[model samples]
Target chain A: MTSASPILIIGSMAFDDLELPTGSAHNVVGGSATYSAFAASVFAPVRVVAVVGDDFPEEMLGTMRGRGIDVDGVERASGKTFRWAGRYDTDLIHRTTLDTQLNVFASFNPKLPELYRDTPFVLLGNNHPALQLDVLEQTRAPLFVVADTMNFWISGEPQILASMLRRIDTLVVNDEEARQLSGIYNIRRAARDILTRGPRRVIIKRGEHGALLFDEDGIFAAPGFPLEDVIDPTGAGDSFAGGLLGYLSNQQQISALSLRRAMLHATATASFCVEAVGTQRIATITREDVAQRVDQIRSLYEFGASTM
Target chain B: MTSASPILIIGSMAFDDLELPTGSAHNVVGGSATYSAFAASVFAPVRVVAVVGDDFPEEMLGTMRGRGIDVDGVERASGKTFRWAGRYDTDLIHRTTLDTQLNVFASFNPKLPELYRDTPFVLLGNNHPALQLDVLEQTRAPLFVVADTMNFWISGEPQILASMLRRIDTLVVNDEEARQLSGIYNIRRAARDILTRGPRRVIIKRGEHGALLFDEDGIFAAPGFPLEDVIDPTGAGDSFAGGLLGYLSNQQQISALSLRRAMLHATATASFCVEAVGTQRIATITREDVAQRVDQIRSLYEFGASTM
Candidate 1:
């Protein structure tokens, strides 16, 4: 892998129909690769490898290019774009999927560009295990590789996911996915169990509760930014992964301290993602906005030691 | 209030029967006051003011006394003690209360000892707001008064609880209680709404998710220790309050920094509380253990500023 290699991201690029407690949005541009790429572009150049239908907005592709993202790898398939419709409960924690239309995405195959093959940092966004594995196979020896997945893949393609898990440096999943993958309810235990199966580090994302990073060095817990209003939560997880991998790629090193700071940055980025529908907030946020929120998050957990 | 006054605690003294995923324990000494007193005693002298029945074991009182708790105000009634039986789900988060026998606690009233009436630091444990008010009236002007309540009191005695809320400097409640009291589902919104009503600060305890401390300065979030095993979560909230107020009483000052440190100590204390049923782990933990855990927790969230 070359030192100048970009951060390669592979996942679905689609549209989302969200029914939130406060409001609803229809056919908003949303997807794992889209959010992750935008989030990572804030820290490092991002190359997105995913399929979208011809119906996908040309302006969205131009937006990615404007954000310094490499959109050449994004394929324009002939059919309808993947679409998801979900409704959030009053608590904004539980979500019920109303419908999932995987049109062009149903028979998708990620085709990495020749330049993307030499990428030193890679983020495999939430997707099928086989697809993630294919991307990994195509990439050169990455300095760091982080993979995010959901309960669907963990339960549906257990063997394939396990195989993919063995090759990644980090695994990111929500609390429920961690529990389902590890067969343990306690997050600490779940994380520890997942670490044994593969990945050097496991991050258990608890939404507004924050995230926990478990590795051999020890556990680092990052507090989520306390937002006064969260209009939408769609794509928050993808954005978090984006920010994390983005920061790591920029640093080109992995340590407990770096991971801790990256988590805070990731959390700040995700906070912005939830402030509006889809990637509206993240898209408009500058580095200054992310830095200010990161500072706030750092202050939120910083406590001087007691002399006693 | 006398400068040397011990931290006064008023709540139930009961026998708890707990059914956990690992095992079961019957007739274990458990109560808000008992846990709080023991936890607070680790940092400051604690005076417990509550009524227990003759059926309550004398050795339990001796144990408190051995731990340096003042029990002169723990009146011995002539009936069975308050008893509670609960079972924890496998997740160790959702607990089902099977039985609650008020017994001697039903008609009882707190009568603070002469020495305790002048205590400067007071912790009003989970009890009826009316009874808590009575205790407050008996105490001569405490320098710092913190109160804890549950969903039951929030829903059952809204007016009395609101009156109590107006008097305390700090209010501690679980996520559900905060939501119920403020009529807001979002935690940050709930905490801000609660702060507007009364108390200078509001700490929303999110069980396994740790806690959020909201005040005029801003908010402080503490992460829960990642424990591989959590035997029973009973009395965790009370112990957290105990550790918090205990540290505050020892410091004899309330600032943002002090509150942050107190939250860490409180988190460590609660971590030990869940290691065993009822107050078993908390009753035996030394100050050194708490300090070491606090250091560990501090490290868990510590990260230096990023260069970029």
Candidate 2:
């Protein structure tokens, strides 16, 4: 294994109720933090900062611990855990949220461990922009900070999201959110507009089509690894973020080359995340499995080019 | 200019009325043959075989001839030209066909001229499967054959489409049509299933997202060049088809490397197609213009990869 760096991730850790066309599962161990931490652990040591409740499973935490994830920053609250219930469309790309019970998560506050504050990489997963700001304030001067946001926050709390955008090195958003955030239909133009807002780079995730990385250097397009069967698409974006930041943390320096390589790892990890329900597929995969998939994904874009 | 070879194209030749959010245009020169012939002329000598009415503009035919496109195979019937009207959605991806008057086009019987019978490359543009078969039968011995089909024929006439599929070297269809034709939602699986039906390769076009080439050698993905403004997407697919086969005709042989290079040209040409209302941008560009765009698009996927 390569020299692994530690990545600090701050987001929700909760139980999920998922309804797929094939079947349904309740009380599935899920959340932005749960998926991100597991995916990140494949490449680097992960420090998760989130709030779970007394009812949350101890075995899942132990599984994460066995995978090299540090849970010292996880707060064990007295009340029930955060829970989300959603039903996926036949396409698996669209989902309708049936319920969101904040429970203990409603009043949760993130206080990072001292060791996490000094971590070189930080992933601020989807949450209220104000809460993301609170976590950002707790961290020391990290080398890189990547944040993910959705349409809910963009419309509900724009001012806070705008403030949070200014503090991060990269902003990862799905294509629709990018359009909603920028108010521009043209993706390249929308990304250019977002760059002026604050983030140095914007990664527009087009779930199945692929992902595009827009920064001052130019645009980098990475094709999503085409799959025969995508059993579940939950946590794909977060997994992509975790894998990207995780791989970058281990790099000696972040260049265009390194960023491109990180995208390869990110795409591979997300492909595995959708292979089965919840995080079952990604949680069990090793670093070698990710590396193999990375090779295969890279082949999708390989052509005989003498120069760029 | 690189020892250009001849490419025969068979499809519609007509006028179109296009409505866009920017504005609307009437009597714009368009059709599968018109777009493909113009795009093909950049890298090859194009011979167009289609039926146009007496009302068709001679000036447009002259314009095509000026670009190395031979219109001798164009048969002018005694009637109004085929006319199609469509309104594009604000997104510009979805369009509602307002009207389609297949005047002389309804009687389009593509018969290759004696000189064109031996053309080395052939692009059987979108038409009825039986017409495509007629064009294929007329060709003496072509080095390569690439055909484009749409949903209209896939569902309207499946048996004939299947027969045409077996004789072609490659089949190009948009993502939706690919899914419908293969009865599979997963694109990779759809393309795999398509290969079993007959064609040696399948190229699935995903409009603004990109294109995927699936063959026995494996998959090759070419990203769509992100444009700041897309005035009209009419004829973009046919333009891509023409550019690919045109570029391939000049190559010594069809191999993985040649196919990849052809896709670069195809993508570059299609990007230009959407820059204007009809075929204005593609019609006005030079060979060097295409090469420059090809370089720019190649940079989208370029990384420091030493090997596949």
Candidate 3:
């Protein structure tokens, strides 16, 4: 795959304070746009469009610069970076947000830089659907437009969510969000309904269970790798979205083959993401580690039939 | 492949009352034994063993007899069969048990006949753990044995379930139950934990997400057919287990290949189980339908490898 430059990510950029069973991690680098940019930058140049506050460490920007992540559109203002304090109950599968301080991120808007406007792929991470729609309007038409959303949007702004789907090419959401958005309990049906809205493809991320890719013709199932343990699942989804759109943008192809491969790759990346609290697990990981884990993830679910 | 006589299941035979957003179907034929027998009968000659009251329509038994399912084990007694009423609030995925009357099933115990004793495979439906254990003890050592349990057993009587797992060859539990039983969130690890306790294999059924099979060296992931609308999810899991064990028993080879194939076969059967309310959909399904759907499932996950 050739290197894709200026891969733009329009979403949240802030800090996540997480409490996990193992231990508590504070001021860990988080936010959909931040983790995604950090993750995708490993494969190609990443341009982020998000807002942070004065408290957003300049050292983090230095770290992004070290990895070649461009934060040209990451506006810094006189406010605290969005701070979210969440606790992963004993059941690490689900978490309850104790508090969400949207601070600088609350009224923020995404502004695509001239260089990022025509980026081959634009990834809209979990945010308000209206903002996602606004981001799509600003981005230059490219190879594909993929958007991710949360349950809040599904239940609160479904009309906006449905209408916004028409502007993007691929939709990524958790399994619950998909079911809630489509009013279909069967995931395949929910994806089919979402596809009807606009995006030709849908990816349902089933946190620990793995994910499914539903396109026009068929569905593919991938099993999650057994993470020795998940320290904190805070930013796993954004990392997955980052890895998915990153692979798609880098490959510059949207065939079934590419999507399946991307699903595996994205899942593999997320597997590493959960190994530690926040995005620290994936920050230092190498592409070779990802490649190796991808093979393992595929083999985890590999089966062959014999005429015998 | 030759047709084989299925292990007759005799237990609660009842119609479920369910309210769904898609559409409502009343008095849909359901109950553990009913779903189990219908699922097993599709692949082989099945015999049901249970007692129903006057309210229990004789035609339902006739329908089983018409399908080559033997109702000789069905004992018509007094009051009513076990009736469960549930409502699907939002997604048909989760149903709140509105009401459950033990009815005639409260004190029923299954006694296998000489013909039934010799059967190679037997599935102890989800009932009191002691009752299920009793049925297992009564049946002669068949080729294989599996028992299903609910959260009530897992939480109410852990020791009995654990000991029961030791006596049986297989145990089918839902995702949450699997976690509760094993005290682990990582399914792969949970499977390993269950395998060590008693059963040679552990099957974790993740409702619409499909199922997972874990043994010593390998793990297989099966994604459920994404359905557009789930009318009523009641009895889907029981039907899935019936088909899984039914297929494995008939195929009669407990190799890795057979187990994996059986998982897929069970999943395909469950897909049909959800089309209508309760047993009505599962009862009408034919083997050809199952085999074809299984093939479709295989193809959806199939991939051509250019290099390995």
Question: lDDT: which candidate is best?
Answer: 2
- Model 3: per-residue lDDT, tens digit, A50-88? 899988889888888778788888989789999888888
Better of 2 and 3 by lDDT: 2
Question: What clash pairs does model 1 have?
Answer: none
Give the C-alpha miss distance for residue B225 in model 3, angstroms: 1.1
- The number of the candidate with the highest DockQ is 2
RMSD per model, one decimal: 2.3, 1.7, 3.1
- Which ranges of candidate 3 are over 4 A from the true structure? A1-6, A21-23, A106-114, A128-141, A150-164, A179-190, A226-228, A304-308, B1-5, B8-10, B21-27, B303-308
Cα RMSD, model 2: 1.7
Q: Model 3: per-residue lDDT, tens digit, B30-105?
A: 7888888888777777766776777888888898888777788787777887788888876666778888888888
Using lDDT as the measure, what is the rank order of every candidate, best first?
2, 1, 3
Separate DockQ for every predicted complex: 0.58, 0.61, 0.36
* DockQ metric, candidate 2: 0.61
lDDT of 3: 0.80
Off by over 4 Å in 1: A1-5, A304-308, B1-5, B304-308
- Lowest summed lDDT across 10 adjacent residues in model 3 chain A is found at A299-308
Looking at model 3 chain B, which ten-residue stretch has the lowest summed lDDT?
A: B299-308
Residue A222, model 3: lDDT of 61
